[model samples]
Target: MTTQEVANRYIELEKQGRWDLIQEELYSDDIVSIEPDSAAAMGMAKTVKGIDAVKAKGKAFNEGVEEMHGGYCTEPIVGGNFFSVAMGMDVTMKGAGRMKMDEICVFEVKDGKIVKEEFFF
Candidate 1:
């Protein structure tokens, strides 16, 4: 699949709350996720290898969000085996209140599977 296809697939999976879909479709057997600095997760970029780890991370993210809305794809900058997804994510929390964070999510695809993923928010 093309970079646009890869990017679009992620957006779709996220919207549908299918972390498993992202694991099976976009990610390879081993995947690494680089969390953002401002993110609640520790480490700016931690390599969470394998599908289970990725899924756990996804669940954790979902649980953290008190109310999440206003998600969109602003722009997709595609390249060979990679796509830079510019997005807007509105997250409301019990304590922090509502905020919209512009993010750049990068996917590393090999043979149509995302081997590594990272986000800068």
Candidate 2:
């Protein structure tokens, strides 16, 4: 699949609360995900290395996101095997109501699976 397609699939998996969907289909064993600093996640963005680490990151995000409303993607661009996207999330942050967070994600797909994921805010 194309890079934009890979990135969109990740969003879809998270929306469905199907983190397993990503692990089983899209991820690389050495996947690395960079998480940005936000109210829910404090400190500078950090990278989670390996498949296990990536799953932990997803759970960490889920801990903060009690509910998801709706969202969209824009500026989806691809170069080489990497797809980058600018996305916004309309989410309920745990006890907080709705909040919007702008994020940029770069996904590297190899052999039809995502080998890397890096995000920024």
Candidate 3:
């Protein structure tokens, strides 16, 4: 698959609420995930390495969400080996209450697999 193909499929699965499947299928084993400095204050690691680590992050995040009101990953803008999407969500956390979250997520793909994902809010 090409970079665009992978990105499009990612958006498709994301819209279907199938993020778990995306990481398993589209991400490289050594993929790196980067969270902003502010996220560390919320208990999220600033940098997460490996696919398993990424999955763990997702699990931890899900465990913190009491309810998901709604969420979305917008269409990606592809360029060379990268693509970017605007994503956001409205959710109530276990103890953090309800809040709206928004960010731009940029992904770097190589050999048809996503290798890095960085977020900017």
Top TM-score: which candidate number?
3
lDDT of 3 at 72: 82
* RMSD values, in order shown: 2.7, 3.4, 0.6
Off by over 4 Å in 3: none
Q: What TM-score number comes out for model 2? A: 0.72
Candidate 3 C-alpha lDDT tens digits along 1-121: 7989999999889989998899989999999999999999899999999999999999999999999999888899999999999999999999899999999999999998999999997
1 versus 3: better TM-score goes to? 3
lDDT of 2 by residue, 1-121 (tens): 7666776787777667576987987898887776655623553337678998777777777787888887767755778898887878799987767888788878889877898777777
Backbone collisions counted per model: 1, 0, 0
Name the best candidate (by lDDT).
Answer: 3
Query: Distance from true position, residue 102, model 1, in Å?
Result: 1.5
* Candidate 1 C-alpha lDDT tens digits along 1-121: 7667887888788778676777888888878777766664532235577788888877766676799877777556778888887777788855668888787888888877888888886
Task: Report the candidate with higher lDDT, 2 versus 3.
Answer: 3
Kindly report which residue pairs in candidate 3 clash with one another: none
Clash number for model 3? 0
Please, what is the TM-score per model?
Answer: 0.78, 0.72, 0.98
- lDDT score for residue 28 of model 1: 82
